[model samples]
Target: NQFKAMMDSANKYNVKVIVDVLPNHTAIDHTAVLPALDEAVGGHDKLYHANGFTPIKDYNDRYQCTTGEMGGLPDVNTENPDFQHYYMTYVNDLLSLGVRGFRYDTAKHIGLPSDPLDSLAARNNFWDVATGREEVKGLRLAVPADSLFIYGEVLQDKNVKESEYAEYMDLTASAYGHALRTVLDKADFNADSLLNWHHPVDGKHLVTWVESHDTYANEHESAGLTDEQIRMGWVFLTARQNGTPLFFSRPAGSTRENYWGNNRVGARGNDEFKHPEVVAVNKFRRSMSGQPETIATADNGAVIVVSRGNAGAAIINLSSEPRNINGVDTTLPDGDYTDAVYGSSFKVNSGKLSGQLDPLTSYLLYR
Candidate 1:
């Protein structure tokens, strides 16, 4: 009943829920893990790896890395047909409860039996089975075609390519957040450099965030993103032409107590829900979702101007001092415009939008 109530509220608010699935390993005490361990010691019908090899440190060895125990959690031998059936049954039950999406946790660890290197082919190879399509004609009957959204926690790096998993689901752009944190700390942060940085995947297929659960709980203070900087990142993340942005809500007392423990809750605050600046920017992004982007970075990347194909322009000043950005190609009809965030009016002349950015502030301007 509570689940139904939650889903009803989400539907009322046009929110899509993505469930997290952990298919790599079972808890040390989980029923499946216990049985598997029992089978390993007595019977041959084991669900887990018996006599597990040396704990896998580097995940480069795709085969052993996926099958080996992680932190003593019993690694599920996903290659086994029996395990796949049991896993999908659990997933289908959730599907029947009206879930439409999934976020596969440690998806890269769910390896196919055929690939030795955890190649792109192997990494993306198990969706058919894992998604319940391997045995069924079209996933669960409750799942409608083209309605299921899935993403994975495939943390991207030089060794791990986020693009390889795009076909399955959007991969978290962890590096993108790190890059944003790095530049936001600079006294002369260049807006142009931000524009020129290589994105891991196409915007549509990337899940962009300023902070994730891991980062928020573990690295918030250490990451050096002040509250103001985090808010600025939120504005940019939401206003971008590509990617879906997720906002991280910092617990109220966590800031004061400096507690970064996982899944622990602090007092709730009304500020995140009622913040006017954040509310205004979300509206701006919602209204300008399909517009093309024209970017111009100047002042050695200190001031970056963006025109969203006549929909609007965003002027960002990353520096500590106030900055006046001029000669920005707005790509809009010459006319008067106002910043949606700050509510300041300005004039556009000859397609050039001129504006002043306050210290460490951004202007979300539009007609």
Candidate 2:
């Protein structure tokens, strides 16, 4: 009832909800694996892979990665016909409840149809069934597959099948996030170094992020990043014309001094999502859609400017000291403009943009 009410509210506001679906494994105590519910999907024996609880010894081994247990959770036999039907029915249930999209968790661990490491009986058609490419009789999505926003957490690995995953849905651009973090740490905003997504598939088929939950919680890879650093990264990525940018909200009451405030797991994060600069950049992204992007760096790589054709420009200064942006090149037309976020003034003359940025500040200038 609570979830339904939330979905109803989201629908009233025209917001689409993307639920996370775990396709790789299930909790050890999941009710679906119990004897009573297990029978519906060909009993417990057929529901899980034959590997039992064997932890994966080598992730590079595609067979083990797909079939073996991960983090002590039992791997589902996604290739099983009965389980496939049951899973599809589960997905249809979510769709019926107003889940317009799904983010497949541990998607890379799921085997692709072309994976030669697994035998024919072990090869799964889960992607095809979920995406409506291959339909199951009496099991259909409540909404059209094209209308759903599907993406997968296919973290980059030596054996990752990124192109194959892109064929089905958008894949997360993990490498690009790492690259952006490196540039931020070095305080070097080189356009050439920062612009490359480094993904095998086209940028449109990738989901970009500055920092993800995994980066913050699991490995603490991005846990040390200050909110300001994240904001700068968000502005740069969101201003681009390619992949969908995801903004990760940090934990509530958390700060650089206190990493985990309130220590509340699964609770809503801090209010960084509604920061004025973030809101402006999000609006700028939507307004500048379809416009070509041009990137330039100045002030010894302290400041980076992203121009969206003649529509708008995003100026981000990463340095702690105030920097003077002098004669930076941009695609914005020659005109005087005021910052949409900070009210700072800037001028574009003969394709050259000049502006003054306060310490660690950003400017969103639009026509």
Candidate 3:
């Protein structure tokens, strides 16, 4: 009932919900795979890999990576036709309940048809069937393939077929996130340093983030980032015209001093998503969709400017002190503009923008 209510509320707001679907493995004792349940379901031998609970010793070995246990959880035999049908049916059930898309967790652990390291038993057309590119015998989805938003967590690694995965759905741009984080840590706004996406596919087929749940909660790699730093990175990412940018909300009540305040599992996180700068940049992104993006630096590379064609620009000041934008090159048409978030005034004249930005702040200016 709670899930239904959430879906209903999301629909009322015209928001699309993408639920996380673990295609790699389930709990070691997941009810469906238990002895009694497996027997009742006619003992579908291919439901899980024969490797059982054996831990994968070498992740680079494609067979063990795809079939053996990950973190002690039993890996699913994705190559099995019966498992494919059952998983597709499970996805269909979610779609029937108003889920518009899915985030396939540990997608790289699932074998690709082109992976040479896996034996014939480990290869499958699971991606094709899941995305409705190839039809399953009796499986149907409540939502069509064209209407659903799908992305896979195909973390980049040796033998990971990213381009093949892109043929099925968007893949997370983990390298790009790392680059942004590096830039944030160094307070360097070098346009050349941050421009490369480091992906095999185009940006449209990539999901980018300033930080992810794994970066923060699991490894604590991004836990050191303050809310301000994250907001700055987000402004630069969201203002771009390419990849879909995702914002990770920290634990509820979390602060610089208290990293895990109110860290109840499954509870809603902090409200930084509604921050004025974030809201402004999101609006700018939506309003300027399809516009070409240009990156530039001002204030001795302390201020980074991301301009979307002639529509608008996101100017981010990454330094500790205020900076003056004096005749910075821009694509915005000549006109007077005001920051959407803070109402700061800016002017574009003769193909250049000039404005005063506060320390560690961002301005969204649009015509």
Candidate 4:
């Protein structure tokens, strides 16, 4: 019933739901978990990598790679077969709701199992949704394996290895891709070199972003990035390659409009969403979406560069002040073009061009 209700809401707004699966601990009120906590609880040891001390509510993500802490939600013992089965069953109902993809909230909290067993359990449950999660049980069904999609909330865990992640899904966890977030949030660190930290080409796929619900929730300072800054942040994400880059909720300047139902909660009157500038972002995304993985990268403001699958080529400026530093490298049909970020175009005659970029702006011109 709740799954149906959730799907109904998602359908209304074209959104997705990520059913939380706590493989380490269950809710404090969970009757099934009472016996485990009180009696001689057996199993679930591997699923719950408890420290020598009792577990706390929120696991610190800044350290101890591959671990996270949800708000007071008890971690589930992912290693326990019973818990796994229960999770699978829950997935069945969720799938029946016509769910498209998943956002594994607080992925690090999972008592990550050994090898493919844990990984397979986590993903198989998702695909087995059609048969009410019976793939792992008696009368296994040949569920359409590729139906369900999975994306993880890896958060700040940087050390989550790609090799380990690739075992489970194709588009996998962000390789601690929070570097983009760090650059956007940390004002002092918003320099050009920050782009170097983007980890898109890892063994698994990754789509980058500048902000999200996690960024805006608690830390007020981190929540609201400026319009220009947000656009600039997305310019890289929308234009770059890797995983299916899930964009923001609202467009630029639309945040003040509350497009995402910000006024719903009777909270301290906290209401706002991303602005409508995302329109431009979607335009860029639409143009580049699965478009042969063209790429451009620059470090330390040296150059703003790009390539259309090593075919089309481009180079722009990232410095605060423009300078005509020659030594052009491009594969464009030698001619002229315009810069998207700065607005004024350029000439690519003889495979050479010079241009200027406004502060915090970029350029994308190709053949």
Leading candidate by TM-score: 2
By TM-score, how accurate is candidate 1?
0.82
Q: What are the runs in model 3 whose C-alpha is more than 4 Å off?
A: 30-41, 116-123
Q: For residues 189-298, write the lDDT of model 3, one tens digit per residue.
A: 76436777888899988999999998988768888988888999999999999999989989999987788889998898999999999998988999999899999888
The deviation in Å at residue 221 for candidate 3 is: 1.0
Which digits, one per residue and each the tens of the lDDT, describe model 1 over residues 1-367?
7877887788888887778888767676546445554443343335555423337777776655666676667665565545555667777777776678888887766654344532212232355676544563233434642578777877664455455556556767777777776666664445224553355677687777877767765645324566567676777777778877877776544453454323344445325545666787788787888998777766766766667888777777767788777776678779877887777766789988776778767777776
Clash number by candidate, in order:
4, 0, 0, 29
Candidates' C-alpha lDDT: 0.65, 0.84, 0.83, 0.46
Candidate 1 local Cα displacement, residue 334, angstroms: 1.8
Determine which window of 10 residues in candidate 1 has minimal summed lDDT.
117-126
Query: How many backbone collisions does model 4 have?
Result: 29
1 or 4: which has the higher lDDT? 1
RMSD from true fold, candidate 1: 4.4
TM-score of each predicted structure versus truth = 0.82, 0.95, 0.93, 0.61
Candidate closer to the true structure by TM-score (higher is better), 1 or 4 = 1
**Whole-model lDDT, model 2:** 0.84
- For 1-367, candidate 2 gives per-residue lDDT tens digits of 8888999999999999999999658787655556754886777767777764678898887888887899889888787767777878888888888999999999988888876434425456778877888766567666777899999999998988899988899999999998898777777876336667898889998899998988887868887877888999999999999999988888899877777786676688899999999999999999999999999999888899999998899999988888877799998888899999978999999999998899778899987
Report the C-alpha displacement of residue 56, candidate 3, in angstroms: 2.2
lDDT value, candidate 3, whole model: 0.83
lDDT by residue (tens digit), candidate 4, 1-367: 7668868988899776655443344565444554554332344344343431233433443222223224444444444445445565556556678666556655544433332233213332322332233444443323343565665555444444433433344333233335554554443234434434344445225535566655544453334565455555565555555445554443323453342333344333221224333444445545654545433333434454454443333343434444453435444556667655345666555645555545555556544
